[model samples]
Target: MAATISPSSPNYHASISNTTINNLFDDSLTEIFCKLPCKSLFTCKSVSKRWLTLISNPNFHSLFLTHQHTLFQKTQALGEDLDQPSFILKPYNALVITPNSPSLQLGPLENHLSLSFLGPNFEPTNIVPQLRSVLKFVFACSNGLLVYGNPRPRHRCIYHIRNPLTKDSLELPCALTLCDHAGVLVGFTCDPYYHLETDKTKNAKVSIFSASQRRFRVVRIPAFSDTRSAFDVEVFYSETGKWKNFLVSCPKGFACGFFLTASSVEHEGKLYFMGGGRVLVYDPYENERVASVIELPRGFGEAYRGCLGVSCGTLQLSEFPISPSSAFEAYSGRVWELKHCGKGEETTTTTTTWELVHEFCLPEVVGPGFEELKANESENVKGCSRILAFHPYVRDTVFLKFGDNIICCNLLTRRFKVSKYGGLSLLFYPVIPIVIPWWPTPIPALPL
Candidate 1:
């Protein structure tokens, strides 16, 4: 009835029945694969040519993204001990990556094979014989992508845009003109509309991240200008893969000194750069030529250090004044929130105002070494302190640094705790905070 089959025969396994997975339709397969973690989906590509083909399809990516987003909607914030303490500080000195990616793993046959951090456009002049990789100096982060560049001055800088979650790196073409380090400002922003509410299942808010359909822009403003505040700004679009020059001159008298050390925050659909006692607002998506500027609550001078960040869906700025303290011998940083003060929300940047939100002190919870300063009321010499960052999701939590010691203070509770990540470079490599949304962001899933 049946032909005799041997082990070497092509039809030897024909008599065996296929598994349920093999019988699944492409759409059905994708639906199931979407439920699994992203890392597992990547490994599934090795199962068979059919599985690889299904996962590689662009349509499959869209569906998977939507389904993952649905799962996110079902989850609740602050449900666990992690009141979403999910934000991470990405530094320029560290090219931190997950060791779990299959493509990033190094093989003994090829020593030091991975240099994706440097981007594809630039070539390194020298490398250690046994070194495995070279790190980068990260400039900015938006959505889930990162912008880092080559550090060698001789090599200038070839900027690289990276999706840390996907390991996708696009090497941007060299800048037409390198903005000098004196007072240059660089900012990154991703389109929020691409991540708008989709999948008519849940009443979910738009995600703080964009993936699969994400489009971003990298803005580079010219160096310091003492004359008029007008300058030709460069805008890079990921869709066209090109840079277009545009002039932004909204309000004059906008000056920023040592802007390279300042931090920028992106809220709603615009980027807010705080420096020179002013906040420069730029919308890379909608407004083509308008760059609105906002005045700070208090003029920040050399005696004070400032850090800008967003918390509770509003913009919050912290100022660390190395000045005299009215209360305890040791002074605490002052927090201010940008408020819409006028009659209605119709006010622009020029009309908006900042209100003092909270004044926090370093709690003794951080242990010893602070009593001497508090006891020495006359030694009003303010210890070297800095406002590191504000908690992205937390209401009133902010990170501070006193020399090498890192402390996290909650303005609501007036308490403080030392951060594990201390002794970082106090000068060049400032630890920039990148917020991780509830579900898709990597900081929560991956170890720092």
Candidate 2:
């Protein structure tokens, strides 16, 4: 009924049809592609424009992250299960970049990369050429960006708001005039209400820095004469770029020592300070108002001092009901939940209840002689021993510091394992081109 097609036309048609088939399965194919090494992943991008797009999409990026996390979990499981214990104490001396977004991969680099560890003796190892030189203490990372602070004298004690994955860093200047004596830099996430005046004119207040500024000016807080007691400080965000501080009363003679620790978490548009066995919530915008204090469980009042050592100011909420409320404290070998609600807010007045959810105590995995250190016993030790929470999607993982040794705990399973070697700190890098389940996959499904 129609003109016969030529042999050459049929061959061309078949080639086009094959490509369409590949495009249809691009998401699945990209997952397979991300498993390859970073260099190899780059090379595979040239296979077709469709492949390139699939690799770059944020959805596909999430797939890669998930794969990487899966691989890491698998590796850790294998190390634990191995009978011969072929593990090597290789030092990973590089910047640890953890992304806030479960799907977004940092930089153009793959999810995981290897770096030379400098060791516990503070010896300098051969530098990895591809990695950055600036060593930053990264606390919390989100949306492809990281919240880091440099404690060195050379860097002027500034916080580097950066995206290591993208190699983009922003230097946020210290808000305090006395940067040298600034107890600690606490970062909070709060939503400040912004209002405009009448007469059709916009009321501009504090100015935050734009990308062009590179370095943002510090938001000045009113100075206090008492140096012995630490002040509860927080940074609030509004429509404009400015920092507003809200101060809360502290215990007498609590300032000189490390009593108050900053938190990297922003809960319900507010920043929190943990100290004196209490959680004080502050609203940066409402400077005139008093801070709300949430009392800790009775047992935690004394127990917190020992287990809550090494104040990095980073708090991670557990997935399961570790405590009565969704909130729980992570430190040392234990995971504590809010057992009872004390007299405080309207929320607390109604429910003066105590509920036992789950308690994860560190297992005696460190050999027979090591007795489980009580919270009080460990408090006497010196130096920074922090607990870092790594959120890689479904499972919540926590890092514990006991003296120099670092222990990693899988919150989902409540299993604990120690690092191969002891070091000052442990940072998790999300964009180093390694396979982690949280990383984005190569190809993503399109929206219907």
Candidate 3:
């Protein structure tokens, strides 16, 4: 009976164990698959039925996420050489038409899609289809997720919450109340406690799903006040699937003009909005109805453009110095960190003070000035280097726009690198890679 095996029979090869990945034990297979990047794991899913099942298993995802966290912990303990933060750049533009005559026949401009990232390796990975037809513009980034919406008017617009790493996107129905209102501003925040509630080991690696439903909070506020220094605000809660409305009043005499592209930063559960001369702070989660405004630290002029961000558990301001400089670039980088002068959670926003933390010149950061800009400084003023974005999490890092290049600088380390993304209306956000792919079991239905 032992000698009766035939080459044509499927069982004939069963006794001869093949040492391929598919034949490895479940525990061994998970260890190898978990090491691959999100995109690579997507590719490996198609290798075989066994692999697809194992990779798609809930248990596998939990283990992979645990492993990623462990690696991150180790990197953090080891310091700079290992756990440096990462960044991603995405460009956007609006569809403009004649203000007076809607039918003037000025067609839409060509849209360009360019995405690049600077990670621990410093090498940029080019993702495909840089131009996504559905992605009109990105409004905010919370954790590793992004909230993007269509360029169409409020009535016709739709918003999408996406995880760029997993390529899982959720298209949400338009929030007419939030979108239809003029001067409305949108912001996103990632719940720090989101992971604790959702970290069950049963269904971790479900593969394709948006991160929004799992752990994201989106808030909407009016930029300008109908009343003096006060605005109405609304919040979208993922857990309950509802929007909550509230009001925020800025300190007396504080005036802010939020541009179409102005962005807000969320730090320690509070949102900081940049105004003409002060930073408006909104504590959405707190019971407070009024916002507290902080004036620019003394010696920091209000004439120049400024951006707000949170880094190292403190709020920061990065100002583009409009002061006269001999360099061809009109603006030099200026950074400041907000320090709390008083204690207690009640006085956190109102009692904070700012201190100059870092500053760098364009020429020193970007190496050499562009050839054309060098020819004539005043002539190239329109295209002068400017601060584009901040490292949302880290205050010391800032992104600069010098002509066509996007420069990334780490103020603490004094290290700068020019980004490889090329597109109009450019912006960037930072992300830390992990292998947890969350796929919602009951597909979320879109509003009609």
In order, what lDDT does every prediction score?
0.56, 0.37, 0.53
In candidate 1, stretches whose alpha carbon ends up further than 4 angstroms from where it belongs are 1-35, 49-116, 119-136, 151-156, 179-183, 192-214, 225-227, 299-304, 321-331, 341-350, 364-384, 414-417, 436-448
In candidate 2 the C-alpha lDDT for residue 290 amounts to 52
lDDT of 2 at 318: 27
Best by lDDT: 1
Q: Compared with the true structure, what per-residue lDDT tens digits does model 1 show for residues 108-205? A: 31122133455453332223431112222556666556676643323335677765544566777776665453534667776542354543565543
TM-score on alpha carbons, each prediction: 0.69, 0.49, 0.66
Q: Estimate the lDDT of model 1.
A: 0.56
User: Which lDDT tens digits does candidate 3 get at residues 166-222?
Assistant: 456676645646334334456776553124223367643223223544445677665
Error of 1 at 146 (Å): 0.9
* Model 3 accuracy (lDDT, Cα): 0.53
Q: Give the TM-score of candidate 2.
A: 0.49
Ten residues in a row with the worst lDDT in model 2? 428-437
The order by descending lDDT is: 1, 3, 2
Tens-digit lDDT track for model 2 on 179-253?
Answer: 233234344331211211233344322222112212211222222324423354434232334344545554432
Q: Sort every candidate by TM-score, greatest first.
A: 1, 3, 2
